[model samples]
Target: MKLGELFQEIPMERVHRYAPERSLDLITNESKACRPGALYVAIPGQRVDGHWFLKEVLERGAEAAIVQHIDESLPLCQIEVPNSRRAWSALSAVYYGHPSRGMMVYGITATNGKTTISFMLDSILRGAHHKPGLIGTVKIRLGDELLAAQMTTPEAFVLQRYFREMADHGLDSCVMEVSSSALEQDRAADVAFDVVSFNNFSREHIDQHGSLEAYWQAKASLITQASSKSVAVINLDDARIRTLQGQSAASFLTYGIASKDADLLAVDLQVSGPTVSFTLLIPRPVYLAGVDRTVPAGAWPMKVGSPGQHTVANALACCAMALAGGIKPMDLAPGLLAYGGVERRFEVLYHGPFTILDDHFANQSNIRTTLSSLSQMDYNKLHICYAIRGNRGVIVNRENVAAMAPFFKDLRVGRFIATQTLGEVTEKDVVHDEERAAFLDEAVRCGLAPELIPPLDEAIEAVLDAADSGDLILLAGCQGMDLGAGKILTLLAQRHPEQKAKILWPLNDRVCGQTIPHPPNKKETQQ
Candidate 1:
């Protein structure tokens, strides 16, 4: 494409040296990714400033650089802008041909329920005969292809590329999880959505976001930025989401469980065995702005393959967005029935006499939900295992341990094992002393005993040794527990080789126990 065509969509601050006829090959923020004829964007970051690497990128192959400051001496074309992040976002869409603008893009943000809603919404889109794609913490999907996701929301450049691919694949709609980090960093700055929803919120990522108020601001921006034509589906039960209603210019569609004023209400929620059933009531005088305001007064039996009352709430949000998009309640049954569950949210890994569940519990809300679900299940004995949360800082570690304390007290397990990756982690994942101290202090404060274990291999042995045939083993944590299920199955394969095929676990790209561990770094603070 020519330089003039790329900048045609978004206005530039000032072009220092213009060559509208010049051919452009690619656009990138990272200096290392620059190739011949690439336009490098100097986006300022937390640790390293792209401005400092302008000379390096120019030395390599970058011909034109978009920067906040003008550099006179560099032998390259420079475009100056006030905010490169937003510029980068706009440029990315222009480079890839604004793909999301044509489709019905549904963005969902919250402390939890993001993944579950993504799956539920995807299923709903399919029922409407719309080919859809998904992008979230669990994975990214384009039709039948599931690729491992590096983040909950990828960078703007990558996002535009994925949108282009989805559009080329003939996808008419998309439902994606929008993370607070991505929102704060303007990763999805230029994404124009047809509908946006804010699920429940909680105290999560305070360490990274600096404060709860800041985290909420990051999450609320998605709803606030929507155009007036778009619809904002909100949770009526959550005060945090309710408070942001005035900030949004978009039409509002409210859904809730306990709130009687909700436009879409799910009532009489019951969890039986491994399925959740509820009566979806779209009462008359339903107060949705742009949608059919007066929905037919009726109660429909709704059952989900996923187990939890919370999952039903997630489905309610999906129904709200779908209804706002012009789907009737009667038409929603096919999609809700077709939906199963996302991987690792509350996935059953092993289903023999003993059962194993894999959950990535990063916050108090997530830990509480999983524990509450466990309380409802029929199990003779309950064994809990946690991975040593690393690099999240002391506050999160303390809160997570505080969340698990009640479960430990209720279960009355003799002792639970906590394992670390033994420095088998990157610099961003090293455990800090204060974090471990917080966990230990909270465990002791709650009258629970926890044994610190090293090298996950021995921790699994300890948990299995204490387990009976009907016991439930929960392998839980964030980064440290990614490979926990695979390792447990590997051990089971070694003991009972015939049952290897029967073992069920969350499917991901995490390595097994056989992979060699990274050597310890003296600078790193190992727990």
Candidate 2:
């Protein structure tokens, strides 16, 4: 594509060394990845600014560059823009022929359940016999291919490339998890979403976003950015989500479990073990695109192959997006049933002598919802081995421990064992002293004497040794607990070699964190 074609419709600050007719073969934000005819976008980052790499990228390339700051000294051809990130996304879409525009694109954004909702919707589209792709926290799927995802939402260049590949592979639709950071960075600014959803929100990534209000605004942009021809899936049960009903020009599709005025509702909800069954109340006629007919208003029995009442909200969000996209209601239940759950979102690791569950207990809301769900299940005693969220500030740590304190007190959990995952995490995830103190101090304040275990492997062994038959063992936390489930199952296998097969059944289909030990970095904080 020519320089002018790629920059078409994209607002620019000023153009230097005008190259409207300049042909470009590639575009990249990274300086090292620049090729002969590539356009290097100098994005100012948190630590290292891309503008600093202009000399380097210019050395490797023989073409133009996009910049927020123009340097007149260097002979580098520059296309100045106010926001390099937004420009990169917009230009990437143009370079990729705006692939998302050719396919039905769905986005789900929230502090939690984004992965689950994306998976459920992907399954629903597949069950309806439509080839669907997925981009989420767990993995990225394009046709029969499954690529591991590095983040919740990938960068603009990669995202556009993935969409382009999916379209070329004959994919009819794509479902993705949109993260607040991605929205704030304008990573998904150019995605042409046919349907988008705003699920529940909570205080997460506050440090990265600077404030709760800013975080909310970042997430709220997903729904607000929907085009007039699209649909915005709003969760009416959440007051925050309900406020967005009339905020967008897109057609509204409201769903809820508590609000009676929702266009769709989940009633008679039941969370039994690893499955949540509910009767979905569809009060109005919905067009089923797969069947090419509109189904009349009625209640239909629905089941999500994942646990917790929180999953009911996820299921409803998925149902709303799928239904609005004209998917058959009958296909939804089957798709949700086949989901099986994400890797660490309350995944059941072993259900043998003592049941073991793994969860990404990231924040206060997540920890509360996860423990609250376990409170409903029948377990002799709940043994929670928490991997303290590392590098996430003291506030989040305090809130997380505080959230679990009440559940621990009510569930009669004798000891609250917390681990720093010492060597098992990257430098970014290293637990700070203040964060550790916050968790411990909060637990003590909530009338619980928490046991501090530094090593992740030892923590798992300690919890497993203490847990007895009929008790529930919950390996919890975000990055710190990624290796907890694998370690727990391995120790269980060593303890009972004969029952090893039964104990390790859950590891067979895990999409994420399947690798053991995680090859810890020795530079991480030890204590």
Candidate 3:
């Protein structure tokens, strides 16, 4: 790819360069990983700025640098773009040889359920024999290799690089969870998506976005950026979907449980234990060549690995996207039945005489939804070992505690253990023991007597000790509860070897207990 060709795609008129002939081999940030002829993007970060290390990147053989502020004295190729973040996205696409052009990319964006839907789409694509690459909060799966994710959506340059790598690996499709910040910053601008699915949204990231409307606009940009021929599969059940439909020029397909007029509708819903069986009604025949195939609407029995009504909704969205992407309706039934829930989404840890659920419910709605789903299950007593984060900023902490209050008010539980992940830093201040104590005390004042513990391990032990036959133990939080839950389950199995035969995890998978505690860091208050 020539420099002129790369610049042609970007909206910039003129670019200031200190070295134009530099043969860019790659774009990276890590000075150690800098290769000859590579472009080092100097990003202005909180802890450290790449601009400060320009001399280091240049010394390490970086041929070019993208900087927010230009230094004329630098002999290296310096491209002064309006925003380095946007430039990273453009440069990465060009450097990666525009891998997204050859692949069908589906950007799933929402406040919650983004991870679940991304997982479902990947699973469905695999079932249909399409090689899929996934980029989300949990991890980035590029064929056989998996790497822990540092962000819900990585920086634009890195994203393009990953997409190119996936393309090189012969992946037919890429599904990613598009965060609002990513969209607002134009991380996904250069790439064309085959489909963009709008899951339900709620009030979140207010601290970053400032307001709900701003957040909504950021999410809406994903749909607006799609090409005219692309498809926008939306959930009519969400009120925001209507506004999004008005903004998009792409072909529209709506799916919902409530709307009878939806392009795909789930009817005659049945919730039996962990399985949700429902009848899908697609009133119109899908036209294929000369044949107008009448897709028979019938009752489909499917078992989601996790137990939640939200999961059912996610399944419907998956089915809609799959069908819109040219997958047959018949294939959807089997795919749904074979679909396994993603890690940490209503993941059941153990089920012996007692049950343990490991769900990553980080928000208010998710917390409420998870509790509501558990209320539907047959358990004598629900013992919740809820680990709340203190560094979530004061507003989020209050919202989360308020959400849990209603569930605690209704359910009769043997014990409610409330613990905090100490030394966690957020956009706000550091969440220390004192802050957590205050939050827990507030919750207790609201009629929920939650036992506060310093470490998550101790909280798990307490929950297990309090639980007996027919008692349900739930470990709910976003941070590192997976390892804590796993360790407790393993200890329980070792103590009562006979109950190991009856032990059940949410997905019936073994929990790998591993804890990597965070190093202490100073917290800064949100502006």
The C-alpha TM-scores of every prediction are: 0.92, 0.92, 0.87
Name the candidate that leads on lDDT.
Answer: 2
Clashes of 3: 5
Cα RMSD for predicted model 3:
5.8
- Superposed model 1: Cα runs more than 4 Å off: 285-297, 504-527
Predicted candidate 3 versus true structure: per-residue lDDT over 1-527, tens digit per residue? 34444555655433455445556556666666565756677778667887887778778777677788777666666776777777878877886788998988888997889988998888878878788999998778777767667678887767887887789899989999999988987788877788788878887777677788898889888777767767777888888766677466777777888877777787766775676767777776533221222234444445555466777789889887776676766676656767767777787666667878778877887888888888788888888887676455556666777888877756667888876644332333346555576667678667778787757678878888988888888887776464565657667877878766554233243322322222221110111
Better of 2 and 3 by TM-score: 2
Q: What lDDT score is found at residue 179 in candidate 1?
A: 96
Q: Please, what's the RMSD in Å of model 2?
A: 5.1
Instruction: Give the higher-lDDT candidate: 1 or 2.
Output: 2
Candidate 3: worst-modelled 10 consecutive residues by lDDT: 518-527
lDDT of 2 by residue, 21-52 (tens): 87776778878777677789998988999999
- Positional deviation of 115 in candidate 3, in angstroms? 1.4
Q: Identify the superior model by TM-score, candidate 1 or candidate 3.
A: 1
lDDT of prediction 2 = 0.83
